[model samples]
Target: MNTPHIAASRRTGFFSRSGVRRLAVALAAVPVALLAAGCSSAKSSSDQSATDVINKLGAVPIPSAPQTQLTPSADESHPQLVAVGSAVAVTLPSGTGTITALGPTEDLPTPLPATMPTQVAGTITLRVATKTGTVKVTTTDLSSRDDHGNDIALTPVGVAQAAATAGGTADFVVRGTFSSGAAQITLREDGHVVAVWDFNIELD
Candidate 1:
């Protein structure tokens, strides 16, 4: 009888419908997977952008300096000398931070002082990490003194302001016009000297 044939056809149709449903489910999941991947890529791009901003702070050409001294000493006044490419950790009023001397740059100071011409220029990167509350650090909080007892002027470069909150970090770039000879970079927070680094400059 035709009843048996009908039963066979119905079974085949059921399997076909089930397979189509499975395919639909798989197709629906693809967009979600792609969206997740896109989110990850976006985060990576954002992190890279942060680094780019820091590098652009020294976009101008830098003259070569032949010497960098980072000798450790027992004298409490001068603990350790930080090399040009090295980083030093410091205690912040609100949290902690690391300061790195990115080395000299040719970016001269604006409107060169008629009396005090700039002998050298340099840049430094500061990273602030906070866990308790929001904290802000700026180039204005820094000072530099040359071996000749000259006070070098410090200024903020790209992304001038750095602010961080709980479990967050911020990057800041600071540029300064230094005099000839070795110089010292100092950081002051809340009217207290918190950190320091030395740089030696040589010119042809």
Candidate 2:
């Protein structure tokens, strides 16, 4: 996939003012307490969905009875703000270069991360290798969906902006909180992820 291949695209509807009015009218018809109770119950059920991925990743690298859940559960529809994409032609800031090849996590060169913990927690410096001419780079947030079809938000630690050169490496060190289990971090531009990093973080 040279030019970034997007998974299947689905059309999501937005909530308009009229739609809100209708929903308000419908809600007003029901007892407020019942509505509150229903919402609370839904929240409780969804909270557990995120952990399902972490547990499964640990038990089976590949699930025997693997079930895929769309991010933002298909049941509870959410409008997609816009077409997910990276900043087009978002070049490096200043004193930054392009990404060529990533180097090793410890000692990196190009297209490689400079430093990363064998595991990660809060925030850390993430490095990538490109050319000696690299500078003015930034790493963006990562997004992934779990088994429950809900989007998991991830933040990078470094620069995800486009490098100075067409081919260079960069490191993104974003703060993140993950449970003890298996997961992958995706590189995002706009709302889409273009790259990925897979690892496991033990909850300490």
Best by lDDT: 1
Candidate lDDT scores, in order, read 0.59, 0.37
Instruction: Report RMSD (Å) for each prediction in the order shown.
Output: 24.6, 20.2
lDDT tens per residue, model 1, 1-204: 556454323223324665455445555554444456556756477655544654565222222222343422212232335655555554455654444555666555477556554376667666665555565677777777889888888788776678888778777777876666788877667656655677777542
lDDT of 2 by residue, 139-176 (tens): 44445433344444545443344343335554455555
- lDDT, residue 41, model 1: 50
> Candidate 1 local accuracy as lDDT?
0.59
Q: What C-alpha lDDT, on a 0 to 100 scale, does residue 171 get in candidate 1?
A: 71
Which 10-residue span in candidate 2 carries the lowest summed lDDT?
73-82
